[model samples]
Target: MCGIIGYVGADGALPIVATGLKNLEYRGYDSAGIALNNGTVDVFKQSGEIDDLTLPAEHSATCGIGHTRWSTHGQPTDANAHPHTDESGDVAVVHNGIIDNYESLKSELSSHTFTSETDTEVIPHLVEEHLSDGDDLLSAVEATIERLEGSFAIAVTTSGQDGFVVARQDSPLVLGHGEDGNFVASDVTAFLEHTREVSYLEDGDVALVTGADVTVYHDGGTVDRPVQTVDWEADAAEKGGYDHYMLKEIHEQPQALRQTLSGRLDTVTGDVDLELDLPEQYLNSLEEIQVVACGTSNHAGQYAARLLEQFADVRTTVEVASEYEFRGGRDPWRTLVVAVTQSGETADTLSAMRRAASAGARTLAVTNVVGSTAAREADDVVYIRAGPEIGVAATKTFAAQVATLTMLTVYVGRQRGALSGDRASTLLENLRRLPGAIQQVLDEEDATREVAYDLIDSDGFFFVGRHLGWPVAMEGALKLKEISYINAEGFAAGELKHGTLALVTEDTPVLAVLTDGAKPDQTLNNVKEVESRGAPVIGVSSLDDTTKYLDVEFAVPDLGTLEPLVANVFLQLFAYHVADALGRSIDKPRNLAKSVTVE
Candidate 1:
């Protein structure tokens, strides 16, 4: 979850490096820096946004590397920012992702004074120290990789070397070659001004980039890195035709889910391909299944667990990633571990994958980022196919995850012979209709937007539901708090009386969900309890149910197999609309950052 940029061209390198870092600013904004060779290596770094940075007027060099950091190893500060240099100041490094074993390495480094809290600082120092011991720049980088643990996509530069040295383990890094020179970045955006043709680096791969050539290696041997064409325009990554990236992303959900469900669903076979190529014995032998995720993804996991257990007849547990590994109840080896993450950079989920791997379990990842840490680390990975969701609130990615997991449920059920042909057909049909159902709710945005306004001004908001909608309610509350910076709570409707009811007060908004048809009466009962205590009630129910016992009512498409997902999207829109009305920073909310790379 950071950005890296490197360049080698006849043009003066500092300005290109600075501009590239600015383009990567959206990915990270905490700190910015660059290292360029102007006879001697010149490094400039500062805390805060790149716009506020002041670099030397000129660094006369044709090769450079830069970084924009979202702090994980240290707090956002100048002392801990990147472009970290070695003791001799001859070698400098810029990095994205984490170095998990840095603490041990830091303790072992008695020869250098560590100036930064960043794990990235360890690289330049290690490379320089290794070079001091007589290894060339490429050999030193290779040696350092052997001693390092955890995810990293690093670019190292030295005044003496004629090229940029790059290495990757679990993080993303790409190289773009141009007639002028060669380039590197965490994504295509940083170098789109130069080229559209790029090469992707796989785990344990290294590349050496110079003005005339680009060579790749694995371990210590030469390797050919496959070059891929990036079809997305530079402006597609921009806020095209929308005021905010959040709104555009929300609007993109329909196509995103469709693409996610397309090839994976097999209508004739009534199964999902998953693309995992999981062994038949392993697929059939699973005694239990576990899904680990964080934030909105956890809600998707909850629904998947319930669906898999009910429809597939597999015992399933959905656990929050932040707390999953420490929970003492589950045997990891006997379970199929499925880790869900949108960025694929979530630290907790990655750690949980390691825990599951250590316990000898089969591991799978469902993620949106191709070649992400979670994707590359897991034993098997499912791509959600939701391209580039930039909004920190995560609308399209969440919906896409749910759709893919739904197909996975049916796939596992069909594989295990637990799902009857008729039942599988019904579920697949419903899955196909989900996009339309969601679109119907989106068409009624005016009603939900008004509801959002009413709740935005309230003192406090509470969301409650029974059964499956409980997770939806939690997600609704999370969306509100995440973007609007409001105080909100989501509780199981049945648990309202157990001390949570005390928080209900006049002017407090309570959103109650009744998608569980059988529990409408019970859900209404819970609403009555809150209404009796003077809380304002807003009911989200089926479009067919015209009757309203609450102060406000929001209708949603009522399809089986978690119909609330459609309803939940409407709630997500509500939260976003309300946050917008309040003049809140809908994309980058205060005190929050996207992709928690640290615990």
Candidate 2:
């Protein structure tokens, strides 16, 4: 998917649209383009970043749409960049998400001269044909989407029309109500600097945005979406004195976890009071909990699965959302499917939630967003409460998600009579102290930076752990690969000798998780396997005895099964320092978007 920005207002549109595109740069893109409608449409586009894009020096266009494309239809090329126009250059369209029926539509419009190898080109041409049929730009866009099939959010503008028209279908689109102009974008962050007052657009909804106001249409009738004021400042999305957004978010984990656990826990009764609407009967009757997620969220699910089984006596399975399919043997009435996504709009997770709901299973969304598709569509919702992680590589959200799931585990455990009050109280007390523990890890950033600088020249990296540590290992490796662009892998410690041991070398470094609940003895034995091969070992350990066996050791606070999470902070800092030293784009990694809206 990509970023989209549209504006129709009294002020010049080019500046607003351009700045919006820059704000959305953290989403990751291959090319950038903008289309302005003065009397005739003027398009300026390039195959690289917005910083290098050259536009008109002077233009008075007050209505326009801009795009930062990630190259879904064609390879990154100047001709393939967005603002795809009609043959006569009458209409310009910028789109996010794929068009499934573009090939057929292109074949039907053979007489139309296409300029780009993109499904987006067909939209402007189709809108042009409708405009030729005496339809206004809004009507033309409405008709154009009716003939297409796919997940998309599109912004369209024409030479003859003053305002822009935007439509959403299985994709995210929001409108920003500003005093100077009205804005449309793939997300609220695009226009947050201009106006925090915004409204979300749902599927099958289209809106006409103008200098005066926003008029939303659903199906065929007018609708009013409530405008809410965003609580965060525009500069929250900015890196606050940190080298990169990833580093800033990593340090913010303590506060993020506190926000997630705030006012939801009672150590005395061991109860969690969340907004989840599931009945007490359903909580007790739950035989299995299937978590569907992708990427780092999937790792969070994996980590939470163990807690659920151990604390709640419930069978738990973590499935990658893209490959999720309910087994036929499980009773739908007793099954609860949890969709875990940092961005509630994750395409695969939303689709998996729908699949489970269609099969009569109860659904819950564990997301950071309030009105996200997953939050809206699921039967219940549990927010992680980690605000606005602008880094493409997730840092704070992972910690918050695991913390939230841990609270959910405690709530279910107590509800099902699986855990005693004393046991619950201890966990709650530990949870209360989690923020301070994470801060301890953050305080060791200087040493972690030293170790990272030393390991930057390693041939490869391997992160290994058992049980709870396995998921943390996976997440650590992901951070390294995502930001440092290193060749890294994570696996169960016991499985190392099976085949992975052969890949170890003197130049390679092995980071082992030797935490309390992850069976440190077995992992310690595996650490010896790498040490024998002359590989440097960096240990994230809670046990003092294991530190002697490691070449370098990072101590984590003792939190029983939660030590790996504190250890994760050290890993995040390590990844950040390495990426920073290498001069890699830590906040916006190449070829990766902050949110994957396309499957």
Candidate 3:
């Protein structure tokens, strides 16, 4: 993963690119660099945080491109930092993804000298060759892209060129139109502070930015891309009153879930009108459902897998997107592949969805981003509608994803004659109650904070659950370890004694999801097992009279099968408070990116 920020305006370049780099640092912070064109191109870069990259206090240049990298090709170093330039340093480039044919391209360009071991260096040299042949900046970059093979979002600026050229194939790039400037970045947040009027560039799209204006080209012809104002304001990206974006997002879950459920659910008739393109014939013949995702998305897929199987009676399986194989003796035409990604640029998820698509499986993208690659390429898309999640550690998006997939499940089940009207009605009713249930949990944050403070010194944490609660437990552990950096693991309640019991100690706190639908009675046995070893048990329970068993109990309001998902808010608050207590970088944890754009 990497970040790209490019600007062409009347103002100085250094401050614009520098501030943009800091704003997008969460995307990639390993190494940072900026290439400015002030009659002559000058590059400033370092293999450290954005703050470590020294730059001129003031620059007269009106255009520049910057990059923050999360090392894909070369290791993070000053030489490996981007804005990789040509021999004369006249042509500079900043890229967000990998160059698949760099070795071959590097061998071909034997006359040119390379300073870094990065694949991105090939581009500037290729552009330099094109420019030396009397090609213009846009033509040079277009020619350079012809020789390049792989997923990349590139921004190139030349000393002699009045503007910069940008192109994207697989990685994301957004164009922002501001009052006095035009911007190019990997995401909206990179330039959200300057402008909300933006347009998403699709695959094979290229653009040139010059002095408050942008011209886009696709398929060798000029294209007029529609520019729309973003829904959320610049200040929404800020932490607001919270200590970290993670905490703010954790508390924003109720509103986020409501947004997901809004205008989609019909509680009376149990009908879910997502208005998808999937036909009744297709839904009737859909024999298998494959959910493809990575990391937290994979956990959400796991949760959705259970729901799909139960609701639609479909043979459903969850696969970590990278490891997904499309051909497995299954009838592709009868299979439905669901790609779940919060940021639709996850390379592995896109690759997996592509494989499934090429095999003839109808693919659906369930994502929060509106114009993301997944949304653009999928056969159909269901928006999660959780607007503007800025936390590197996902909170509201996870709940929103689960809710959206549940609605999809209901829709499919109704179409396939798997779910009765009463059954769907019941599920919809419970789904509608989700936000209120989570709010009840959010109200108990003070108690959850106390639990976090008490367990702050623990050696490790164990999250255990069963049934629908399984993925919730896994997600709970993921949140704690991601932000707090605690040694946390989640397991099926029945599996704790298989081999995990040996690791339990008095210093370890067991977080048991003993809710109404999680098979609480069986999980209580594991709770007793951990309690026998003197481990403190923090139970998320709906069952009454569990006071004697749990060391710290967070009562979950009953929402039937959805109660386990409700318990997740407490876990999020617990992780936030623990990370806060340890003075951790909860928003941007070390060595983690919000979007993984490289496979």
Candidate 4:
């Protein structure tokens, strides 16, 4: 996904636009560009990071639009960057999603001269054609959008036009309300430094923004959108004192978990007061639970599925969102399809949720964003109240998702009478102390970092666990490979003899997660198998006895079934330190973006 920002204000637009692009760099982009509208549109572009771009010393333009592009239709080149313009160079457009029918549209406009290899080039030309046919700027943009196909969040500005037009169809776009100016951007972070108030644009909506006002339209009718204030402070997006945002976010997990659990749990009554408006009849429907997610969120879903099945006594299944198909075979009436996502804008997860809805399943979204597509489309929604997570490899949100789902398990168990009062009280009390437990892990970061230093030169890494530890193992492998670029694999301890054992070598460090609920002795036997092959063992456990078998041991707080969650923080630190040592990009890993908005 790319980032787009536009501003119509009295301040120098170029500087503001450039700062916004820098804020969005975590989205992962290869090129950056900006278009300034003074007496005429002046476009500047580069084929590298946003920081590499240079602006004119002084420009009279007070309005402009900018883009940080992740190449899709064309390779990463200056010509392929955004702020594409028409032949006259009067109109400039910065777009975010794909134009699915660009080839046919290009063929239809054979007489037009194209300067760039991008699907976005057709947009400005089409708008120019409409303007030549006696349409105003607003009408031209609206007509151009009608002819285009597929997802897009586009911002268009012309030299002589008094305002800019932005449209959204199946992509994210938000408007910022400011006293000195009006702004449009792909994400709230782009404009958070300028304004906290924003209005989210829905699918098939168009808006025209001027220096002083903003007007929105949906289906040819004028509409008034709600203005919501962002809760995250502007400094929250900044790296306070840490060397990298990834490390800073890793340290923020304890506070994030505390915020997630605050005031929501009633330990006195052992009740979870989620306050979600789902009817009791829907909650009482006894059948099955299906969780759909992608990547790290899918791992969280796997952990939640195990807890839901164990605590709620419900038949639960976890499916990767990209591979889930909701065709007409299964009875969806009694199924609750839970969509788990951090941004809530993942393309695959959104498609999966739509299919589940079409199949008559009761859909619920567990996501972090308040106005995300998944939050708006699902039958019911629960916010994972984990404040903004900026790192490309997720840290805080993963912990928050698992914690929230654990609480959801408690709620379901209460509704189904699966857990008695005393047992529920005990679980709730443990949940209340989870933040302190995780804080204990955070306090032991120096030890984890030391372990990371010890295993920095490992040829490869293998992670193994059982039961709830299995998902923790998977997450640990994912974090290490994503950030450190290490060759790593995670397996159930029992699966080692099947095929994974062959890959174990003396140079490969085997990381074993030995927690309370996961059969510790069985995993210990698996550890022995790897040890016999001369593979070094690094044990992550709360127990003291397991350290005897390990060359190095990382201790986590002993929280019974909750130990796996705390153990994850140590693994996250290990990956961060390893990546930092290797001089890898810890915040923005290569070839990976923060949100998978495109398929």
Task: Tell me the tens digit of each residue's lDDT in model 1 across 1-599.
Answer: 67899998777788888989988887677788888886578888898889877788876798999988766556568877788999878898988766767878998886689888777888888898889899888889999999887668899989788878999876678889787889998878787877888988999988888888998999678998878777666755345335578887777677566656654555665766665676667767778898999999998898788789888888888888978763456565558999999888999999988888888788999987655788778888887766566788888888889888988888788878899878887788777788788888788888888878866778878988876778888989999999988888986898989988888898688888877522555777888898888888888887455254578777767677557787788778888888989999988888777789998
How well does candidate 1 match the true structure in TM-score terms? 0.61
**Candidate 3 residue spans exceeding 4 A from truth:** 1-237
Better of 3 and 4 by lDDT: 3
- Greater-lDDT candidate between 1 and 4: 4
lDDT of 2 by residue, 548-587 (tens): 5689998888898888988888888988898889999877
Tens digit of per-residue lDDT, candidate 4, span 243-355 = 78788778777656765676567788888866576666766775889999998899899989998998888889999999998745667877889999998899999999999
Give the root-mean-square deviation of each candidate in angstroms. Answer: 13.5, 15.1, 14.4, 15.1
TM-score of each: 0.61, 0.63, 0.63, 0.63
Measured with C-alpha atoms, the lDDT of residue 97 in candidate 1 is 63
Candidate 2 local accuracy as lDDT?
A: 0.87
Against the true structure, whose lDDT is highest? 3
CA deviation > 4 Å runs, candidate 1: 1-237, 326-333, 516-519, 543-546
